[model samples]
Target: MTGNGRRGRRILAAAVVAAALAGVLSGCGGPDDVSTATGSTQPAATQPSATAPVAANPEGTNAPLPEGAAVAPSPTGEPAPEQCSNPTASLRPFPDGAPESPALDRIRARGRLVVGLDTGSNLFSFRDPITGSIEGFDADIAREVARDLLGDPNLAEFRILSSADRIPALQDRLVDVVVNTVTVNCERREQVDFSTVYFEAQQRILVAQGSGIHGVADLAGRRVCTVAGSTSLTHLQRAEPDAIVLTVPSWSDCLVVLQQGQVDAVSSDDSLLAGLASQDPYLQIVGDSLSPEPYGIGINKYDPDLVRLVNASLERMRQDGTWSRIYDRWLGILGPSPGPPVPHYQD
Candidate 1:
């Protein structure tokens, strides 16, 4: 059985035992003597029952929330659709699949593909406790890209990045590629290049179970937490203007705030929110996605060759069933596989 399942069963059994003890305590008459009758007739107020998640901030806070935590940019009208204009947009991988290029040359000389990704994102690209190695859907995909480039899957370095750092990492040449769960949009494309969409997910709400909240519409005047620099924040601001949006540096922070009752709900792509929920069974995702998020690898705007190579890697993964295997490993618990997203190239 999975660790989560075992933990859940333990919590369930503890709850049953607690309830039984409470019942037994209630049945016992406290000192059925005249002295007790004169003291008080009403039973003492029962302390609030404890549950699986008894602490508000189990993960703890890193730093105080940023200033203007509730403030967000006003909607700039509906987002414009993205367009691709690079020379390699319409190009295909080399005849051999692994093409020779300066991009490939730099990576081979360096001996490792520096990949920017999130270590805190649970199922996407997190470090496993047992192996102490970062492995997840995105991490696995990045490794495949590295193996194709350098001929060794482990010849890759994972650089942790926050939501805001993805484009900057590529623009500054700090990393050759970013496999973080970055969404593709026209504005972002202007800053960094992107491979074809590898995974498509939709925005949704995550809340502690039994919160009585259903979806985005129910967030009016409620405290909602989302990572700063994420599109989910913008959608939340526009969809529920009255809601108090709390911005944090990472999604893990949002989870901390939500657990502490500092936020009524957390919002993000379902793929990401699923990771959060899996960590704590008390939490659950609610409502439909606020918008579609097409995840793409962030490549340097100047490195179209690398972009093409990464796309080639993705194409092979899809055709060879590697993509589905990764999905089953990390994301199958969410639901049955939906298959890989079709690649779209615009010249």
Candidate 2:
């Protein structure tokens, strides 16, 4: 071969090699590029991804707020029931063993206790992905009630309810009772009867690690998220009037927005915030509790007899160590069992 031909061939081969290297570098993105492309550095095994397929909320977008959730709070519109010195004080339970009542008769006839609760409430009552069954602290509590009434812990039928639907479900007799984390107070007492306080929760803040938010005081002018129709929202609004409060339909939705950077932080009961934190190690619960929330089982107002029966069942759970067992199974993350809340009788 001629010298000129060899020199031209060498230059062309060198140019080709340089072009291929450029393409390879572009295909293998840098660390910043990977972070921006994925929108987060959180481990996929630990946290949900926006593009990942979720069994619930298939679209992967934040769940929509329930109807009327964005509107201003409305009055209950009926004559408020007489105020009680202790709203958590409930009817005295009947003696355990063969407890009978008219409401119990109706429920026994139905054969399955219809319990209302939100499945998206992690640690409280959420769908277990592996078993495809709803299981949590609150779910176990409902099962206990079913065991007492129907003699089989698995005989209860769970009805999914939004936070706002809790009172209406009881009033309309759609469910035998609500085992969701409902706060017992005077306003709800007028609408539905309550069992003794089951779990005591405290409102607090959840934020990404290194977030400037240390407490409610740091929330002013910052975007905060919580479930609509929740006492958490009311307390947050009262605590920081200037905060840009974002209300969603579920606590999971609050976690989604916070992860997506649509909100600065999430505020809710520490029990709930802990659940969110468990799903994402990047998140943390901060600050002292804002308020004490006494959770109770909600029943229809006319079913005073049923209330007595439920209170009786709760007492049995407390004495027999079932409450402690269930709490440890689901809520040991919150530290040692505090034991069950002491029952108070108005009678």
Candidate 3:
């Protein structure tokens, strides 16, 4: 049993490293780099997507393969032969269009909700072995949005994107909404509209087990890892200004780098930091959350109606206890509800 366990860990470790390497190769290798295109399921959006569609398994016509068979056991213990999967389905056709939101009507008339999302974030939208799905908390949120707008969550098509592309995705009409973990900022507002804040996050530091380093001050000259498309990249650069940051496409990969001593620490949102910490007890989240990361849904600047409708839906979810249920389902450990919404904004 011990020997098998050790083998499993080794395989898992190699898989993780490959994932990290793939993130880098994708950008530098281009078409020749098939790993990032194939290895990492969670694409980097530093902020990113709603639930995306899956091939076959559409409407469950052909029953999904047994979950066990779907995943081949990896030397790492993760069953494989099973490719990673997208969290949800494409947006279903709403040919009739939503009369409630004029912007949605326009979008529907054009066909497809071009959703911009992070292709490489873990636990939020990373690859899954059993079902080859891009399953995660972030993807779940996107799934719900696609369900609401497309009348069928399966109708919305997701486009992998990065943090820098959040606003640009909407501005360019490449996407109808950016379900990425986009923080609401003054500058961001200049380019696009935002839904009421959905998640309240902050930057926290993550260090490997037994590492003498405790906080940002220790990071002055040490190497750190942050997701490639995140402001965290810039944040680390500005804070240390001299610290080495080995940026990867996803936080999961960041953890691998830390485990391998490739980087000293990984800094990102508090929830994410907490999530990463939970994945491995050795890694710890330290220091107070330094930056407020109030996440909002992104929409085109030309689409106020869509934003309003989404806000109304969000409010409905809150009022109906749906939001709380989801929270308990996924984030009960975060703490109890703070109270009713603070009422962030209106059209």
Candidate 4:
């Protein structure tokens, strides 16, 4: 065939092939199918209708828990005090020079403080989406410890930990210190030492606004959520034996379940619940405190000197108004600074 004739035939063949391909694509979905940018077609019904009212529970049932979320086993009995008289008291601050210890020496040699915390914790320690940097009350406290130890706050390395992992991380020496919102108790003192109480929180309940679940009294027969391995769980079980308790990996998970209608309420520290409630205007914290929750920095039990050093830094922060500044910056939603908790020292 002549060159022009061959080119014409080739164009005709290409047109036929394109038409066949189009026919096959159109056959794959119904008329209601929507074309996606990736060349895939999805049922238009999957797309939410503009006029369809959103259901609180879309599946007509409780939403599935997030991965790793679990229902806590029923409490066997009230937990014993383990002979702890004053869990809030901690080692005295180091006098003046802040003498060095093996733990401090190791951290100095490493040149940075390895601090463990939960980035999922909203007001305490969470990541900033825009900045991609961790910013919260606990993060700042960890930085202060780094500043006192390494002479630079930026030298601190943050390690994200789960609620159940905080104690193990410290016990295993995985992190130099844990600035997570850990309650100091005699049971915990057995495994790790703690800095003096940095923040005093009170346990409370968070529920949907006007849920008629005013307090712990209303929690009976209702599903409540809290983080696993938390003091909140213990207190909750004791406060209301009839309530169904669901435990998740983080407080954020509790927020998720609450929003999905999987649970009626979330029980935790008022400080933590404030963070959750702030994220969703439909939620509110209700009722008086269930119990006092004294937060302390977790240090390995073997590191008494490091504990003293951390306590010293906390003392300086309290006196210099750094604590108040941090509180006002992150927790102003909870109200005015209660002024940093009075430090109790065991001389």
Candidate 5:
């Protein structure tokens, strides 16, 4: 009977070890699978409970939304869209994805071209302590657009905005053009029009000095920092599913997370990473770009007349030395700006 008891105890020990091994394997989720969604309240970065994105206007494009339609933001995240005055010669009660006059026409009639831009962005737009005016390569281009349309560079109205709200502002006829390092993508084009590709880059990694996250493979079991509602989170999910991702509102917030030792790295477009690298000498951008991102000016699709006017103005900026000048002033350190690509409309 004692011999039987010893054998039974050994069998129980073996079973316990096997169960532990299975748990470890399950966490890794195989080689190409990245499903980290557990019972935890975190629902994928962009699809936030608070900041639910409204379906893009699909009436004229993918999902029709009346141009300038009242956008009811999700109760969980962003505030409602701000009320902005409609552009001149606007015919309908709503944006209907169509406007009558060119942006040039409106500028001439209104006596100024109002540009919606971020006053907080680096190299693109930021307030100058000495001049107390917004400045950046993006500001320079906006000035020139105002110059071309209204014959006075000083005739520019600059309205500061957050990253998530720029597209909505354009759709609502709030700004003539946006020059704050806006990335161009397929889904975005369906809702709004885009200028020619002025900047080309890839997503990269930002790490604290000496933490030693060499590449994506090194992120396993570590926490990564990313901007919420941006491509960085999606890429990290696909590449290092085993790692934890902390989504913040902006890349600046990602820096805050990395500094606090909450995350191992911050991944974003190289241009923005370069901005962070310039600001914090203790941080560095690591590894090659994970994906290509092109920057463009976002315009209202309902304002095709405005689109044409802006495109012509951008072409002029490219031809004359305005684009080069602004790029050199703000982002020359990133590398020379890429050649302009002709605008290709996809409806």
Candidate 6:
């Protein structure tokens, strides 16, 4: 064929191909018409509608607790009265004034009182998002101590401590005192001196709503979450020896596990559990007191004078109704206070 004839045929073929693609894009009924001009053989997948629920993996969260998790040691039995005061006992203020305490003198020399506590405790010592200050019932009590010691509530340096660090911090003198909701027990007294009972907490369990696990009785054979170095783990082990215990670094970690369904429930002091529940409405505290937890300010064993000063401050708080006011500020949701725990002075 001539060159012009060949060129004419090529143009005609190109026109025919363009026509075919138009037919496909226009949805003209034909065998190949189901395809689009872009050459896709199927409809473009539609994005999920705005109101459609997205699927999620409930287990797609932090890993589950490992096997052979650490358990808290059994509490050491009562100590000799001469070594430590009764956990329930506290001293009264001197008739004239707090006697000049060497520990108090050192704290005054430093200008800032150092306190150790968990910053994650919601109602007790968590940070306030708005004011950016760690404020709660425990924080208030610590501030009261600071005020009593240094004449200023703001002159306090809060050092965040893990459950495991409470005693070690005191022993190493890393902190002047620990105002974390430390429970005074026979075993703990051997390592550190504690103030008279400033607050009393009962052990309890927290579970997601409708979890079917109502209390410790239902915890057998199930996974329960608690913090490492916490008395709750020890109590749980004794109460349900067969239950699978999961230990986390913090109480907040236990809440995360329970919310993610990695554990059946989180067990700890009612006050701490209440703080967790306040964060998530779907979570609820169940069960009753597993045991009584008497909270005290932990100080170095060598600093009996500091312990006495803390006890005296607590006494003043109770006398002036400061304890009740602080309680109503953060923990009133739990109900009215039963009145400040009475001081029992061993001396």
Encode model 2's per-residue lDDT on 1-347: one tens digit a residue.
56456445444543433232222112211111111001122311222222222121212354433222222222223443576688899998887554567788889998988898876689998877666677899999999999988899888788777686688878988888999999998888888999999999999999999999999988765667787678887778667654656556678878886887656899999999999999999999999898899999999999988998889889999999999999999999999999999988889
Writing each residue's lDDT as its tens digit, candidate 6 over 233-322 gives 778866755456656556776877677776688889999999999889999989878989999889999987787778778889999999
lDDT of 4: 0.78
Q: Look at candidate 1 and give me any clashing residue pairs.
A: 203-289
| Residue-level lDDT tens digits of model 3 in 1-347 | 36656455545644543343332322321111111212344433222112111112212243321111111112222322332232111122233434556777776776656666654555455556665555566666666676676667556566666555567668977777887777766656667877777777778789977787777767644556776556666555544443445555456667665665656788898777776777787888887655677777788887766876666666666677766666665565557755334445431
- Model 4 clashes, total count: 0
- Where model 6 places Cα greater than 4 Å from the true spot, the runs are 1-86
The better-scoring model by TM-score among 4 and 5 is: 4
C-alpha lDDT of residue 169 in model 3:
64
Candidate 6 residue pairs in clash (backbone atoms < 3 Å): 89-344, 90-344
Q: Ten-residue segment with the worst summed lDDT in candidate 3?
A: 64-73
Those runs of model 5 whose alpha carbons end farther than 4 Å from true positions after fitting are 1-104, 336-347
What would the TM-scores of all predictions be? 0.77, 0.77, 0.68, 0.82, 0.66, 0.76
lDDT of 3 at 157: 61
lDDT score, candidate 4, position 150: 89
TM-score of 2: 0.77
Cα lDDT of model 1 by residue, 192-287, tens digit: 888888999999999999999998888865667887678888777667655556666568778877877767799999999999998898999999
Give the local distance difference test score of model 3.
Answer: 0.58
Error of 5 at 257 (Å): 2.8
Give each model's clash number: 1, 0, 32, 0, 13, 2
